[model samples]
Target: MPTLLLVRHGRSTANTAGILAGWTPGVDLDDTGRSQAAALVDRLTGVPLAQVVSSPLERCRQTLAPLVEARPELGGPTVDERFGECHYGDWTGRPLSELALDPLWRTVQDHASAAVFPGGESLRALSHRTVAAAREWDEKIAAEHGPEAVWAVCTHGDVVKAVVADALGMHLDHFQRINVEPCSVTAIRYTPQRPFVLRMGDTGDLASLRPRPAHGPTASGDAVIGGDTGDTGTP
Candidate 1:
């Protein structure tokens, strides 16, 4: 089996603005996010990736731009919609504060398995597709690139959380306990016997802040607004 590097996209303007940004058009990386993306090139210098995958979302593309530029042999990231951000429907582009007040907010945080965005997709569906995509890609990569080959998937926070939870054999409802900061690198290795989560939220010496409970219902989870802003407030 192949080792998978799960990377969340860098911070975006929406992140700084406290918006959910789900499937929002024109959402790109902020200055801090660009810096984080560039720094990623140096951080993974030696680990050669067999393939670099990405979500079609602009932010994810921008996050991996520097890396692709540095390693042209990887031939850029192959777009994988299955790894895109969770569709928030009516919740898209809304301020996290207001969204936190919605009744579904509690379900998203406490019982994600039952979460279904209005006019959007369900958390259960998101989990199924993403996990299946991961397994499919992992098997394909191993067969094509060899067992020692490594690869990466540059995607969103929730997707990472979902995949990480599945790899850990934890229920989706308990996935809130797993967090991956923006531009962080999480490594997981799959063996014939089982899958192992080698790392989670491995940002390189990046000083950052995570919102406290007072922030909101998703204060500690991936509904992250202030949590990954790199701002100094409420650390």
Candidate 2:
């Protein structure tokens, strides 16, 4: 089996404001975000990573910049639009406060799995795209480098959740069941058989925030941070 490491981009100004930046473009990571990326780099310093792929967004690329610089032998990170954030359509760059005031906003917050943005891609659609892209990448790795290839992908939070849900064979309705934090690293194992999410939404120790190699396979299907369920904040 091959290992796939999925990392969410670090905190951004828009993220702090709780606004939907979507594909508005040019959003950069903040200071704390840079620190988190550095932490990740420290963690993965000893790990042998085969390839690194990231969203075309500046934030995603920046998240992997340091790692590429440190390990020039690993080559440059590949840019793929499929790993980009979910297109918020009409809500792009809108203030979260204003959007929250709308009735539809509640539905989005509560049941985003099925809710569709007025002019944006549906959550389900986003999940499908992510899953397909991931599968293609897995196949390419297997064909080009054999079964032991380990790859890292840098993407947005929502996109990571969608990909996680799809990998776990969960329905779109369970989108909220997974919460992807900025600069978090979630590891999974993908095989020809169904996708097995060995781990999901784990930021690892704050002390080592940068990308690192996983020591062992997931024995239990669990998450480090529990998601906020409608009825209760439970995993």
Candidate 3:
């Protein structure tokens, strides 16, 4: 079984302002985000990832920079637009609180169904594209690298959740349940018969961490209680 390490990008300026930063350019990680990335690099020192993949966005790219610096032999992570955040379209830079006032926002939050952000891609559309891309990448990795190989995928939180939920055989509606915090790392191990989510939302605890063995019956769970649902991976 190969392990897929899904990492949500570090915090961004828009994140602090409660603004939706979907697919917007020039949103780099803040100082805290840089520290988080450094912490991640240290945590991964023992893990020895075989390869790295990331969204082309600067934030996602920067998140993996420390790893490359630590282990220059690992080279650099590959970028894939398919792994980019959800397209927020017109609502990209709007304040989250204001957007929540829209009725469509309510439908998306309550039903876990596909709801487009006015000028953006629908949830269903994103699910299809992301899943397809992930499958392709998984196959390539399995063929190119051996079974036991782990690859780092740097992406946005919502996108990570979507791919993670689908790969683990969780229901599409379950997307609302998996919460990936900023700079948080979730490790998913996939075997032919089943997939296991060994860890989720562990940023501060990465240090002094032991190798987490895989286990799960796909806990019928959702994101952490009170975590953001705005999907910063938007746009």
Candidate 4:
């Protein structure tokens, strides 16, 4: 098994402005985002991360900076397009408040699998690629670094949420129920059977967010716990 750490990028200028920065270039981390990222170094202090992977977006790269600085052995963070932000197409840089008034917004909130953003991707497609990428990376890491290896992924909120939904085996429509705040850490472990979710939306003090053994079996007969697999409550 290989442990995967999902970290949302620190808050960006667009985040503060309440704008949708989908695949938008030049959106960097704001001052507060920098401070949040700096604090993450201390939060992940004792974690033995083998490698750092990030989305090509500037904010994601910037969020990974402090962690790389703290652990030089982890080397530079690798940019993977699979973990990139959702392409909102026509809504790329629109203000969220205005977009929320659109009829499609409600569908996106309650029925994401059926909601396609203007000329962009559907929530189903986002989950497909992101979850596939995670599985691929998990296999690669498990083979290369062995079962005990831990790694980090710095990406967008939607991507992280999508992956979390897949780990929980939840429908894409229910992804909104999971909250992935800026710079938050969500952990998952790929086992011989299924993915085990250890923690979700942890912003600070990872020492208190340690992973525990899953208690029961999944529908597929694999042991699973956390997220929505065992409990109906949010992780």
State how far residue 159 of model 2 sits from its true place (Å): 0.8
Summarize candidate 2's per-residue lDDT along 1-235 as a digit string, tens digits.
5668899998887898788899977899999888888888876654567889999999888999999998898788999999999888988999988988878777766777667888888877888789898888888876776665668899998888888877877777776779888898787667555666645777764222222233222212233345412121111
Model 3: pairs clashing at backbone N, Cα or C within 3 Å: 22-234, 22-235, 23-235, 86-235, 88-235, 177-222, 177-223
Model 2 steric clash pairs: 39-209, 39-210, 40-209, 40-210, 40-211, 41-210
- Candidate 4 lDDT at 114 equals 95
Error of 2 at 12 (Å): 0.9
RMSD of 2: 7.2
**Least accurate 10 contiguous residues by lDDT in model 3:** 211-220
TM-scores, all candidates, are: 0.86, 0.84, 0.84, 0.89
Candidate 3: stretches off by over 4 Å: 204-235
Worst 10 residues of 4 by lDDT: 210-219
lDDT of 4 by residue, 28-65 (tens): 99999999999999998767787789999999999999
lDDT of 1 by residue, 1-235 (tens): 5678899999999999999999999999999999999999888865768999999999999999999999989888999999999988899999999989999999999999999999999999989999999999999998998775678999999999999999989999999999888999988767666676757999984222121123432222234444444333443
RMSD for each of the candidates: 11.2, 7.2, 8.1, 4.9
Error (Å) of candidate 1 at residue 83 is 0.6
- Please say which candidate is ahead in TM-score: 1 or 3: 1
Candidate 1 vs candidate 4: which has greater TM-score?
4
3 versus 4: better lDDT goes to: 4
